[model samples]
Target: MIAHGSLILVLLFTSPLMEAFSQPTKVVTLVMFKWEIKEEARLLERRMLYLHETLDVR
Candidate 1:
């Protein structure tokens, strides 16, 4: 429980900095960007559940 609590606290403290760094770049278009994804290897999902318009089209 303490580990989770401390993780939450750390996330809360650095959220703004993380958000600034989390902005999406190299947007996917035509479904081909999966080839050049830079962040991670999984379909690329946002964990915050925010309604962000990526403006990407396939």
Candidate 2:
């Protein structure tokens, strides 16, 4: 019975630590995704500008 109680306590303590460790990975992934989106937008804007210049030249 004592071992079981201690095991439960250990699990409770570690669960929060595990969640804390996982949070940073999630944050990094979200940050990376945002950066990718921003880069894509920049590329699209550049392409549009190039197209506009070509049309203007013609």
Candidate 3:
């Protein structure tokens, strides 16, 4: 019973530390994802403008 109680206490303490360590990674991934989305959008816009310019020239 004592060992079981200590194990529970250990888990309770470690879970928050684990969450703290993991939280920044989640934020970093979200930032990276947003940046990638913005880059893709800019590329698509550039491609569309290029297509329009070529069509206008021809």
Candidate 4:
């Protein structure tokens, strides 16, 4: 009975730590996704500027 109680206690303590560790990985992924979106927007802006400059040359 004592061992069962200790096991439950260990599980309760570890669950939050497990959740904390998992949360950062999701946050990192979201940050990386946002960075990628920003990079894509920058690339599109540059392309539009380049197109306008070329059109003006003609």
Backbone clashes under 3 angstroms, per model:
0, 0, 0, 0
Better of 1 and 4 by lDDT: 4
> Residue by residue across 1-58, what tens digits does model 1's lDDT show?
4698899988897997677666543233524566557435433555322324444345
Regions of model 3 farther than 4 Å from truth: 1-13
User: Judged by lDDT relative to the true structure, which candidate is superior, 2 or 4?
Assistant: 2
Tell me, by TM-score, which candidate is best. 2
| Candidate achieving higher TM-score, 1 or 2 | 2
> All candidates' TM-scores?
0.25, 0.75, 0.68, 0.73
TM-score of 1: 0.25
Clashing residue pairs in candidate 4, if any?
Answer: none
lDDT of each: 0.58, 0.96, 0.96, 0.95
Clashing pairs in 2: none
- Candidate 4: tens digits of C-alpha lDDT, residues 1-58: 5698899999999999999999999999999999999999999999999999989854
- The predictions' CA RMSDs to the true structure, in order, are 18.8, 2.5, 3.2, 2.5
In model 2, which regions exceed 4 Å deviation? 1-7
* Tens digits of per-residue lDDT for model 3, 1-58: 5698899999999999999999999999999999999999999999999999889863
